[model samples]
Target: MILADTSVWIDHMRRREPELVRQLQTGNVVMHPMVLGELACGNISNRSEHLRDWGLLPRVEEAAHEEVLSLIESRQFMGRGMGFVDMHLLCAAIGHGVQLWTRDVQLRAASVECGVSFTETA
Candidate 1:
């Protein structure tokens, strides 16, 4: 499983380099709900940009319920609190024991605690 971060997704949606984009084609690609929300949260300057990447979101089976719940309550998110969807995605990746392809700095950092791998590909 792979989590596609907002930064990479936005870059792909806009610049769209064939080689770089291919990284997303083969794997069990996904976007953490937070990553999705972050992209969607962007303003009209690139609303189409956000919408373009929506198709890439992947579907994974449910993860260990507690792993997800603990992650949500973890300090990793600080006072910001984790969203349920994000925890599901993160937990699913961890439960599956696969890497998440992303460029989200925070998510990458959180990857350590989540027990999922994160890869940065150009």
Candidate 2:
């Protein structure tokens, strides 16, 4: 199973990348709360439809705030610009033993440093 990141969702919403859309349709994709929140904040017109599609999938519960803050501190020490929501998504992915799919370079690098499994696959 794959834990989808906001980047993939954004790309899918735009219909700019066929591979990403294919993955979403064929892969065992799961959503985290932070991803849903980010999607809700998008400037797209069919926001409700996106949410409905996301809701149909299984969701991974968010990590504890303290755990996310700890991860944030660790990433900061590593000189990574990981944000709270990003860290939360990472923590959820790790806790659930799923590979997070993200296109962000820094996030993928920090995921390696933190031993948080991730993927950059289309």
Candidate 3:
């Protein structure tokens, strides 16, 4: 399964990204809690519909909080501009053994640096 980040979700909400739509339809995509929270907090017009759609996908089980703190303290991503949520997403993706699908450049870079599988293109 692939863990789709918030950016991809935003794009899908706005324009119906073909690949993401296909993945969602096939149940090949998993949702990250942080990504869900981000979407819920966004100014999305079709909020209820989007939430219901996302609710159907399997959610990535929550990663250890300590792991996220460790990543932050590791300082490997010191200047990468990744915040706690990004690190949390990375940690979850790693823990879940899922490829991360994202459009955020910094998140993609961090994923590469940390050896997490990712797809930047649709």
Candidate 4:
């Protein structure tokens, strides 16, 4: 399973990246609430259609809310441009033991720092 960050989803929506599309087709991608919320709040013209498509994907079962607070309290990611949503996504990936696919440099760095598996490709 792969937890794709908001950046990746946004890029995929705009570009229809081949690899990402392939992953989605194969049902290898999983969704996080925060990522979904971010995308929902974006300026996508076909928002309902996009949400419906994403809604078909499985959602991460573990709740990362507390972990997100802990991560913020730890201050480890401080000044690294890591936000609550980023940490939440990282926690979801870590908890699920899934690869985090993202294009955000800061999120990639945080994943490395936290020793979570990640992929920048698609």
- Top-scoring candidate (TM-score): 3
**lDDT order of candidates, top first:** 3, 4, 2, 1
- Reference-based lDDT, residue 54, model 4: 85
Q: How far is candidate 4 from the true structure (C-alpha RMSD, Å)?
A: 2.0
Q: List the residue pairs that clash in candidate 4.
A: none
List CA RMSD, all candidates.
4.5, 2.3, 1.7, 2.0
- Compose the digit string of candidate 2's lDDT tens values, residues 11-103: 766666665566677857888988888888878777788789888888999999998887677657335676777788888887888777787
Q: Cα miss at 91, model 4 (Å)? A: 0.7
Candidate 3 Cα lDDT to native:
0.82
Cα lDDT tens digits, model 3, 1-122, are 88989988888878879888777778889988788898999998977998887887899987788888888778477667887888888888888888887788888877877677566453
Question: Stretches of candidate 4 above 4 Å error?
Answer: 62-64, 73-75, 120-122
Between candidates 1 and 4, the TM-score winner: 4
Q: Identify the runs in model 3 with alpha carbons over 4 angstroms from their true place.
A: 120-122
Model 1's lDDT to the true fold? 0.61
lDDT of 1 at 1: 57
State, as a TM-score between 0 and 1, how close model 1 is to the true structure: 0.56
**Least accurate 10 contiguous residues by lDDT in model 1:** 75-84
TM-score of 4: 0.86
Write down the RMSD of candidate 2 (Cα, Å). 2.3
